[model samples]
Target: MITSYNFYFCYIEIHEDYVKAVMKEGITVSPEHNDVLLQIVEKHYKNIPFVYITHRINSYAVDPTIYLETAKISNMVGFAVVSEDPKQKIQIKLEKTFFNKEFKQFDTLELALKWKDDMIKKYRD
Candidate 1:
């Protein structure tokens, strides 16, 4: 089953093995905002490996340092960003620096979802 949550900053869809987030336009995502993600992880994904996919439908800024805390989530197997914007691809490269685990960028959500499944399978093996 898929579950959804709407926050002031983002709209999140939680699947069995992945969480997709679409951040609101023009907002700056900071480390403090990670608390909301952490809570969702604890409540819905505790002890189970999952991937996080950020679907950038709207433009926004992200604190690279936020990945530092996100990297601590033991159950999180990978992080993927879905965006067609060339600028976002550049931003993702910088963001990947702060993340300790697998980080991938895709032009489409379908591609990201496939990567997420592969990541989870690899993690379980």
Candidate 2:
């Protein structure tokens, strides 16, 4: 997995097949930052099947549209987000739209990773 993080954002790139990768950091609400993020994801990782977000809401509000676009491009089959803030609801809606369905959410990254691992095993078989 490849990772990138700035003061305002963070991302991870999973480079395995039959195995999914996830970004543990959440993104900020800035349009510019989101744009930069999209470019990065597009440029470096476009085929990952799963992505996990761990950015806290206080640091930055993640725009769901950005994640939606990423999922669209990555053809991401599943997503797990860990946030304690209610504001993340908006992102959740956006994720659902991007996935055309609901995604799993957890309060901790460990749960998300465990779930993703189980999912990968299921999908791989």
TM-score of each: 0.98, 0.57
Question: Could you give candidate 1's per-residue lDDT for residues 1-125 as a string of tens digits?
Answer: 47999999999999999999999999999977899999999999999999999999998999999999999999999999999999999999999999999999999999999999899999999
Q: lDDT per prediction?
A: 0.96, 0.52
Worst 10 residues of 1 by lDDT: 1-10
Candidate 2: C-alpha lDDT: 0.52
lDDT of 2 by residue, 1-125 (tens): 44434433444443442223233344345446556556655565466544444434344455556554555544445566666667665666566665543377777766867776776566557
Worst 10-residue lDDT window for candidate 2 reads: 15-24
Q: Which sections of candidate 2 miss by over 4 Å?
A: 1-3, 11-34, 42-48, 57-59, 86-95
Cα deviation in Å at residue 84, candidate 1?
A: 1.0
